[model samples]
Target: KFAAELGRGDKVRFAGSTADLKISEVLSDAHAIADDDPDLETLPSSEHALPSEPATFDVMKRVDQKVVYEKVLDELASGGTLGIFPEGGSHDRTDLLPLKVGVALIAYSALEKDGLAVPIVPVGLNYMRGHRFRGRAIVEFGAPTYVNPDTLDSYKRGGADRRKACNDLLEEIEDAMRSVIVSVPDYEALQLVHTARRLFQKSPNVDARDKQDMSRRFAEAYKQLVARAGTDPPQKWLDLQERLLAYRRELSDLGIRDNQVPGLDRERRHAEAGNYDGDDVLGGGRLLYHIVHLVWVLCLAAIPALFLNIPVGILARVYSDRRRRKALAASKVKIHGRDVVLSE
Candidate 1:
């Protein structure tokens, strides 16, 4: 559908899973090997455990995920796109869960081995009132970020350092997603989790209604923050901080303890990860390109329609005339017998 809309028929090539194909010699030669081995350690332990119950079986399934991370890193290092859901699985209208560190490792390895930086683009997929049918969806591509080895080395040298870096990168991605797409505020989300935990602890017999109330409160807080922080602001840094604080308050009001807030952890990770500023979310550059493309498209359609004597050309002329008349009327300070005095 996208290809047809874009008039790019037969130009789009869809590839199946890269893992199924044998790696070419040239690509294999460029692949990097990572030292991380957590996947290997967890695999055997999972297999040995008895799956007597459903919960036990679920545990085994989680253990199996270790290999996926390792494989993704290897593929990325080999100059291939590793499609990963930072959140392990799909959820209904939830902001992204804390990003798994697997993509970070892949980026680090790729930079170290090939000196080639891979772009991690956040894709937002939204469904309308129903899951299917004609619905509007928008996909915005974020500016690319590279993982440097010198940067990674600094984090790897210290446990605390690495965790801090990881968190920062995750936050950057979250911010990027939020800029182009609708997402739950991080602080409010964390508060929701905290509220749920506290309620569970206090009343082991908590009902579904209590859980619903806690969720509703958190959502309300997020809405308030978004409203207070207009989408367009003069200073994004100050605006973001203010919005974050508002979101934090929302969480606080939901019985989430101050000590439980993840702000400190988020800051620490951002520093360690060497998080950098991204391009403006709504800048003149993209707008200019879109305008130019639209003009070109209009010209193309106009010429073809006029040459073919299609009714569209007539409609376009009428539409253009109406727009011009409206503009003229809007600029008029006074009008006397169709002779209008336009405001200078």
Candidate 2:
């Protein structure tokens, strides 16, 4: 219905699951893989399952994860844009999960093997309400991040080189995402996890406010370290600091604290004037309330039955269509300007 409304014709692209058949046709040319395989012997059983022979299960799980990681890395190296939820497969209200190192590993391998730079773009899909039609959604596209080839070489030589390189790339990607996203406390903590991972790599002792803060500090430290170790420390460090500071400033503008990260206030009003608890069932309840509370909903819905309804509906449709077209037009008006930076 959405595609028909947008005049997209049958060009829909689906990349995720079997349930999405219509869109799946568009992904036929892309390399798509399931995020997890519970049937694999090497994969670990769910935590709810009773413990089995420790040695056997441990070995199998390690092998399974390794195989999956390696397969993904190979695909990316072969010039395929691989998509995996860095947060694994959680559908909770949380912004993100602790990023798996698999993406980082693939990126590092791609750069090392082909001298190719793969851009990891963090896409944040915010739905007004889950599993609903005519709800507003915002898909935020972040900047592409490249893995430093020099860092990969060091990781390749070390005992835990692959793991380290993967973690590093994950941290970089997380930081990039944070720069573009509107900060919510829960999501911020997830970001901190990446920061913590980076800092813990440098020194296990230093700590931040929470996991998210730790991740941010760690990313900052890594950026500083990278600059300091470069040929021109002052210039590189300044540039890096400016970018980081800009991100921090944006967070501040949104009233998000740096050290006092809090979870998302569920009671807060949504931009679309809808309630979203990140649950399909809860969303249904909200939908019911909206239907019951708004008299306009019933009046507008009854237009098709009235004698004059056709003209009224046509006028409403035309006005709504014009408003949308104007919005799109206004969004496309971009200003091109030049800036001159003078260094004292």
- Cα lDDT, all candidates: 0.48, 0.49
Predicted candidate 1 versus true structure: per-residue lDDT over 10-92, tens digit per residue: 11111210011111121132232223323223223322232344321010011344577567667776667866676543333
| TM-score per candidate, chains pooled | 0.36, 0.37
Clashes in model 1: which pairs? 164-268, 164-269, 165-272, 165-273, 168-269, 168-270
Per-candidate RMSD vs. true structure? 25.2, 22.6
Candidate 2, 308: how far from true, in Å? Answer: 24
Quote model 1's TM-score: 0.36
Off by over 4 Å in 1: 1-71, 148-150, 184-344
| Cα displacement (Å) at residue 200, model 1 | 42
Give me the runs in candidate 2 sitting further than 4 Å from their true place. Answer: 1-60, 63-74, 160-162, 186-344
Error of 2 at 216 (Å): 15
Candidate 2 lowest-lDDT run of ten:
335-344
Worst 10 residues of 1 by lDDT: 12-21
